[model samples]
Target: MDYQSIKNILFKFEPETAHHIAATAFELASFMPPVLNALQKRYLVTSPLLEQDIFGKKFANPLGIAAGFDKNATMTKTLHALGFGYVEVGTVTPKPQTGNPLPRLFRYPRYEALQNAMGFNNDGAEIIKKRLERIYPADFPIGVNIGKNKTTPQAKALEDYRFLIENFKDLADYLVVNISSPNTPNLRDLQNEQFIKDLFIMAKDITSTPILLKIAPDMSPEQAVNLTATAVEAGADGIIATNTSIDYSLLKGAKDFGGISGKVIKDKSFAIFKEIAKELFGKTVLVSVGGIESAEEAYRRIKAGANLLQIYTAFIYGGPKLIADINKGLIEALQKDGYEHISQAVGADIR
Candidate 1:
């Protein structure tokens, strides 16, 4: 059967359940040589024009599967085979915690979005580190997104982040300080000045791997600037201009504490990116995440100064073919604009 039929069938199950089934199928597929080979032939898109060098590593492409999609680090190989230039894994906490009860993940097909209160439900850092060590490709760059356990007091959150950084540093190409997930209580407070400085200190001491802060789209302009300055002061390597938006105004129905993601937040996400890019202007890297699903959207973000782009909800709706389509579209857009490299287009709109 085709992917559309399969996705429809999976949608019939609870979101998390469907995710589990899909993960299992992918894991099994990764073991089959023929299937794996065929998928690579179909999905992998390579182009010198898409190459990006940052944090001392070269990316095959800018389009990637964002963090929340593979929370447990279990699907990297299949995801890599699907042609994503990179795959971010986690929101992994120091300890495994049952995320907010069932139905924590909700689909809003009407807007091609999702609201999740998954509360960092991941297989603790240690387990994920082992999983990564066992299978992560030697050269593939993996962004390890780490968070605090729900039971951990906000004051002691750094300890949890420390555990993840110290343990996963050897395996992860970069570490994403995931303090902006709206689903976790009081997590966003870490976005403030002192907390950012302190956290970056620990992150810097842990390893030389690039550290990027994931901020919420609802963060105030003042707060964004403060965090940006603090990150720059702390010698941060980059910023992923948004986690998920908590503003339910764009959404029709009500959700308790989950963060919203997808097309509805496109403009807002890019606006935040532009603000951060103002601070990052030739200094630190700016990676944009939110509401990206098409080649044009991807190019828009790039021109807006997002050196790298990521998608979770969009990836869910588009599948493997989507990655190919976006990459192809990105190349066409660059060539049509008379640009030889994607980097030349970065911040073109802002200028």
Candidate 2:
């Protein structure tokens, strides 16, 4: 079936149910080698020039599926088949929780953006770790994004993070400390200099997996610069430039405030990426994530100093072919700009 047709069928159900069905279907498909192979043959792009090494891991391409798409690591194998060089799974917490009330995920079809307040919902780290151990492939790079549970107090945040690190250290290619998702109350408070430094120390002592700090797009330029500098000093391997925006200006007519994602925040995401890139300046790996929908936008972020790029909202809107399309366009863009590989394009446009 075609992408749009599949999407329409999925959309016919409630949004969250559609997501669960999609993940299950993909998981089932992954078990069939022939089916998986055919899907990859049709969508995956290959290029020696596009291969990239970030924080000691090599990726076939710089494009990855951002976190929040596959929250439990249930379908990494299937996602990798669809063309993402890497698939980041989970915003998994230390304990299982139901998350916020339903209708948390809202669609704004007219604006091509989504507003979600999922509140770090997941199957929890231990369950995810066991499941990952059963399904993880040696060939693909999959990162685990860990979050504090809704019931966890801010004072004990590091304990929550430490629990996951101690348990899932070997299961993930890298570790993302997600302290920026607005859905969780006071979660972003961890972004403060002293708190982030302390958390990194705990992470460093337990796991050698490259640790990446995921920050919010709502931060001020000075705040981003300070946070990046602190993270680097504290031994962080990289920074995922954003989670989702809490700003509602993009949703001028919308009734509620949920995390805003898609084209509406692309420029803001890039600008934040550019500033963070300039501040860190070859010192840390930067993974840009908000509002990327096309190759041109991906190219812009890479040139602005993002070592790797991630997409969620765009993949939802563009369907399965998005990754291959972006990688193909990235190859052309690299050639046009006299770059040999994605790394050469990093910070090329930054002043």
Candidate 3:
């Protein structure tokens, strides 16, 4: 049956429960090579036109599954099979976290959005590191998105990130420093210039693995540009334009807590990303996330200076077909625009 039919049944359960059910399917598929290969054959879209090398890795396509969907490393193989160019796992912490109280994940199907207050819940770095050791060095790229523990004081947040970076640097093709998640108390406060400088400096000292900074979309274009510029100047290899947004009004009947993502935040995210891109596009690798739902949006991000693109909520709503559809649509769009390769379109608008 189709994903929408499946989603209709899945939607009957609470969002978190439905997510676990779906995640379990991917986890199980990892052990079955036949299932994986089959999924890849049907969903995976690869073309020389879409292929680009970033951070010394070959991304078969620019589209990737953003960090939160595969918070643990279990789904990497399956996600790749489902046509994601890369899979970013974890918002892992120094310690295992239960996250916020239950009922923390909610879905707004009409808006194609989700609000999650899940605060860095994961199996912790030690466990996740072991998981990656067994699974890393795959044909595709894998990124580990790390964050500070909830109980860790803001004063000690640097140490938490330092520990996570040290543990994951060798395991992941790249690493993402996730200080901008809105669920963690005082996490966004760490987005300051001095702290970003110190964090990237410490990361550079540890491993040469390309580390990128993930920021929130709640800031002004000016703040976004300044903060990202600071990150790149301080040795960050790339920047993921945004995490999720805390702007509740974007979706009517929104929760006062957690962060909102998907269709509702598209314009907000694109505006901030465009501003950041105008200033820092060529200075570092640029990744655009938040509310990317189609080929047109993906192309817009590329032209606006995104070297890579990621999707989470859209995947939930649009299902697996969306992945291949986007890659195919991107190819068509690029050819129609008189571009031979995806790289040629990167920052076309900015140039």
Candidate 4:
């Protein structure tokens, strides 16, 4: 296999199955050092120009495969081999979860997007923590995204989050508090100022893991500003702007209910990035994701104030080559603007 052939074969299977097969195949390939090296030489772009320092950690490149792709941390090494500078694994809950019923993941090839109500499905934080411990690497930065189980109520959400933090604090490179996924009932409601402050306080006391809050794109500008302020005041290390959008007005006749991601959310993602940039003013790191299918869009987001950029839908549409291409485009974009590094370009477009 070639990329498209493998993609076609995977596409023939159901969406969730294809995801599993791909992840497992990559995990198998990761053991072959020669193969992994060849992939890195071909796909992973390492240039001093692309290096970035955020949240007290240095990234070899600013591109990361956003959370949800590898929910179990089984293929982090392989994904890194495929050119992602970093890999974020799991929306791992405190306990194992079956997630929403079948047909949970739907693909809209026409829109170059996917709508999934996976409901934080994973093998649990303990399992993921053990797997991560077995593959520990000094240089690899693996961020773990933590979520509450479906049975966990809104009232006790903090306890669920703290449980994972306490268990995986030493195992993960950083921690992401994912409260924006549309699949979980009332999950996004935690974005409220009071709730967010309370959650952060709990997270703060448990460990020193850099904590970031992930927010949805459907929020109003006022909501975005308020959330950003709340996170900053609560001592959040960073923010992952504009998670998958629930505003399917664009997909009105196409699909019913689920989070929408891809080109449809590009402008919205950028607008939220800009709003957070203006309000935070480089006080906290911003990881932008949504609608970035090409280098031009990635460059635009970095210029808009994202210290780091992540992709999921684009990886599905563009294949593995997209990663190297975006890094190449980013280097060019930086040169065009007379900047010496990626950090110099952050927030260049915003006044």
- The best candidate by lDDT is 3
RMSD of each: 1.3, 1.2, 0.7, 1.4
Candidate 3 per-residue lDDT, tens place, 114-137, comes to 999999889888888888999989
lDDT of 4 by residue, 49-168 (tens): 998766556688888999999998888888888889888989899999988888888888887878877888899877888898887653667888999888998899989988988887
Q: Tell me, by TM-score, which candidate is best.
A: 3
- Give TM-scores for every candidate, taking all chains together and pairing residue i with residue i: 0.97, 0.97, 0.99, 0.96
lDDT score for residue 103 of model 4: 82
lDDT of each: 0.85, 0.86, 0.93, 0.85
The sequence of per-residue lDDT tens digits that candidate 2 reaches over residues 203-294 is 88887889899999998888998997898899899999888898888775654656999888888887888888988868888899999988
Candidate 1 overall Cα lDDT vs. reference? 0.85
lDDT of 3: 0.93
After superposing candidate 1 on the true structure, give the runs of residues whose Cα lies further than 4 Å from its correct spot: none
- How many clashes does the backbone of model 3 have? 0
Least accurate stretch of 10 residues (summed lDDT) in model 2?
249-258
Model 3 residue 78 lDDT score = 97
Better model by lDDT: candidate 1 vs candidate 2: 2
User: Candidate 1 or 3, higher TM-score?
Assistant: 3
Whole-model alpha-carbon lDDT for candidate 2 = 0.86
